[model samples]
Target: MKRITLPLTDEQISTLKAGDSVLLSGTMITGRDAAHKRLFELIQNGEKLPVDIKDETIYYVGPAPAKPGYAVGPAGPTSSYRMDKYAPALLDMGLKGMVGKGRRSDEVIDAIVRNHAVYFCAIGGAAALIAKSIKKTEPICYEDLGTESVRRYYVEDFPCIVAIDCEGNNIYMSASDISAPI
Candidate 1:
């Protein structure tokens, strides 16, 4: 397993490979489908996004409200394919990484390769456990959207697997290939 800090550089991203387990620490922003749509529309109209995503990682999670003593509650990764429509454009704009669950679209994979970015898969069915890694959370924008709002998260030892790497290797496809009988 590897340990990575947030706002990964090109050198750091290049070192990742699909199927590698990693523990992430530091800051990452959160956004889900609704927020992504807004950002996409802004980009389409040539308007500036409220939050700058350059060289940052966006986690696809709509975190639950914080419990009495916790930063967040049952914070699990959302399905990444839901944001496929907007990911390529974001990646083109210097967005360096993404964290979520499941496979990504081919277009997203192409974008990752084109931009030298990486995609990580958080464990499904482990939302409560995942929340333990988040040390702090603050709303950034789209508050009206409730939990779907974009937020900044300060995390430590957040576990994930490299689902797709800068070289365009995809663990989803690799897993499928391995399971397919000859």
Candidate 2:
């Protein structure tokens, strides 16, 4: 597995390829459709965005409330396609990577290529395991949205795989055409 630090440099991001396993470490922000919609609307209305997305990675998730003694609750990726409409605009604003599950729309894939960004797929149904990688979690904005609020998470060795590389090669597309290794 390749190890990558967050707030990735262009060189670091360019080196990754679709289907490669990655152990990601550093600060990542979490959001879902609600948060993305709000951010996009803020931009459209000529208002300041709540957080700077430039060269940053956004995870598509709506985590459950944290339990006592825990930094975050079961945090898992939501369907990436749900954010497809908002992704291109965010990508245009310098968002560099996305973490989620499922295939993205053509528009999002186009934006990924145009913006030199990447899309990662975290293992679905592993929310509890995923939460273990989070060292810290604090709400950043949209608190009224509760679980859908945008939050910043400090993570370590968070596992994921490159689903779509910057060049638009999608692992998910190829995976279906090939047999699983025995």
Candidate 3:
């Protein structure tokens, strides 16, 4: 498996391809549907956002509360489609990567290609296992949203698959083609 460090550069993103297994390390921010809506609204209103997303990877997850000795609980990837509406805008604003489960919209894929970004798929049922990679969690904003609050996570060796690469190649499409009736 390829190991990647966060704040991915253009060279790194360009080298990734759909279906590549990777282990990501370094910092990434977390945001779910609610937080995304807020960010979208801010952008629409021309107001400054609370967080700087430039060159950052946003993971679509609302991690559970931490256990006694842990930084976070069973942190898992959330369905990515829900963020599709806001994704293109975010990508335009310099967001480079996204981590989540499931497929993304066509517009999102186009934006990913246009911006030379990448989308990774985290295993859905491996929340507990995923949580082990996160070394620290710090609240960023939208705290009132509770678990859906935005946060920053410092992680090491976070496992994921390149579901969609910079050039718009998608593993989901390949999978569908393989399963389609001839």
What do the candidate models score in CA lDDT, each in turn?
A: 0.94, 0.92, 0.95
User: lDDT score, residue 168, model 3?
Assistant: 90
Worst 10 residues of 3 by lDDT: 173-182
Error of 1 at 95 (Å): 0.5
Give the Cα error of residue 106 in candidate 2, in Å: 0.8
Model 1: CA > 4 A from native? 174-182
Compose the digit string of candidate 2's lDDT tens values, residues 1-182.
99999987789889999999999999999999899999989978989998989999999999887899998999989999989989999999999989999999889999999999999999988999999999998878999999899889999999999999999999876455768885
User: Where's the lowest-lDDT run of ten residues in candidate 1?
Assistant: 173-182
Using lDDT as the measure, which candidate wins? 3
- Scored by lDDT, model 3 comes in at 0.95
Candidate 3 Cα misplacement greater than 4 A, ranges: 174-182
Show the colliding residue pairs in model 1. Answer: none
lDDT of 1 by residue, 46-152 (tens): 99999999999999998777879888988999999999999999999999999999988889999999999999999987999999999999989999999999999
Clashing pairs in 3: none
- Please give the TM-score that candidate 3 achieves against the real structure: 0.95
Evaluated against the true structure, the overall lDDT of model 2 is 0.92
Please identify model 2 stretches exceeding 4 Å from their true place: 174-182
